[model samples]
Target: MTIHHHPSNETLATYAAGTLDLGRRLVVASHLDRCDACRKAVRGFEQVAGTMLEDLPPTTMSADALARTLARIDGLGADESRRASFREDFEPGLPACLRRYELGRWRWIGPGVEMRSIVVPGANDVRVFLLKGAPGTRLPQHSHSGTELTLILDGAYAHEGGRFGAGDFEEADESVEHRPIVSDDEACICLVALEGRLKLSGFMGALLNPFVRL
Candidate 1:
């Protein structure tokens, strides 16, 4: 698949530094799984981070620090093995990064539009969901109150930002305001991570915003 859109360098750097929130991290991880270019970029960032750590002044540690660190490393290896096993048995249609989350049932939000909430443990105000639009459907025109990351899982849609196909990752902030319309050929399924509430515009969006909880 040809991925035209990707996470910005700043976002990737934040992700590599483990500073991005869980919701946004999951979105970026999903995109990275599909886009090799982003994966290479992330690896480069990690290498730089490692080099920086190596250059830092050395510090003394407690007597049991080494033992504790070794134990943690062993536990992490076990956790990774379990995660790999889970990914192997995960749903084929969903992204590997999303397999760990609990997905709610799909609910209709608008004509030809359905949303399924993904519950991330300990998540507060932020929200994550799988949004699917039927062919030729036009989503409400709206702007984000905070950052919004969208990763296309299937089909395609077009907005002012560009025409996004499968594997495309779009990042939108408060400045963006556009209505996305799914192509006529097939339904569009996307994984969306919202940092804050969506600021919907127009009569239709206003009427549905409160009920949609988007």
Candidate 2:
């Protein structure tokens, strides 16, 4: 289908600079693989940045200047051939960068909330989950502690923010509290990457709190 929503200019710049985290960079790479528009956009930004650097006043540099500049330039070199590499590395059903992830056994955590983790290679404690809105359900009013990236795998959901259907991705700032309601007749499935512990509220929260350790 289509590439997910184009990353913001800031993200593209970060990708070009090689400063974003690996997980976030992988997501951006995923988009760059399918969207040539974004590819050109990133290239344009890099080119503009390079041009600006050349226009800057010349300054005497220490011995490390060459090495540092080379390191910076290395990340900006997304040659035409890189598209194929990115596509191959992130094929459907399996991400080459995350091939070592062995999904932990999935089980129900609540009436609609269920989770299974795919461990990040070398970082076993760190994992991601595939969650679904069982039947006609949704998430409770909750806020994630860290950056929460939700990619819709199936169906749709509506929240105060708006409606998001299959294939849509929403990045939630930790400050936003949401109660996403399943809009489709079926279910909404999502991939979520979480770091800090999830703080639960409302009823059954205490009951659920003691039930799982993820």
Candidate 3:
């Protein structure tokens, strides 16, 4: 699939520096898995970061630091292998970045739309979820309070900006408002990370806002 949208350079830099929150990092990683261009961009940023770190003054390490670090790496590898096996047994078709997290049950949010919340580890304010909308589903018009990141996993959707198909990454801020409609040819499945609450528009949006918990 062709990826027409990508995270901004600033976003990629932050991601490479490991400064992004978990939810946003996962969204960017999902995009990187499908977009080779973004993957290369991230690698470039990582190289720059490594160069900067090399110039920093050296710090002394504990006598057993090397042993402890190696043990930690081994532990992490084992844990990651178990998680991958678990994901393969359950949600086998998800993006690799999402496979590490536990997925909640799919819940119907509208006539043709369903949502499944991802259980992120640790305390986080960002909300991450997968939304599946059948063909012809039109979401309510809304604007974000902070930032919202969306990565299309399957099918396509269109809004004021343009049509987003598989591997498209979209970033929305508080200034943008839109109503996305799933393409009639197939259902649309997307992973989303929202930093703040949605400000639904119109009277119908107000009525449904309470029920449309993201």
Winner by lDDT? 1
C-alpha RMSD by candidate, in order: 3.4, 5.2, 3.2
Error of 1 at 199 (Å): 1.3
What residue runs in model 1 are displaced by over 4 Å at the alpha carbon? 62-92
Which model is ahead, 2 or 3, in terms of lDDT?
A: 3
lDDT of each: 0.83, 0.62, 0.82
The Cα error of candidate 1 at residue 205, in Å, is: 1.1
Model 3 whole-model lDDT (C-alpha atoms): 0.82
Which 10-residue window of candidate 1 scores lowest in summed lDDT? 72-81
Candidate 3 runs further than 4 Å off: 61-83
lDDT of 1 by residue, 112-199 (tens): 9999998887557668889999999989899999989999999999988789999999999998998999999999999998988888
Give the candidates in order of lDDT, highest first.
1, 3, 2
Per-residue lDDT for 15-56 in model 2, tens only?
776676655554455456546877898788878888998999
**Predicted candidate 3 versus true structure: per-residue lDDT over 134-158, tens digit per residue:** 9999887889998999999999999
Give the Å error, residue 51, model 2.
3.7
Reference-based lDDT, residue 89, model 1: 35
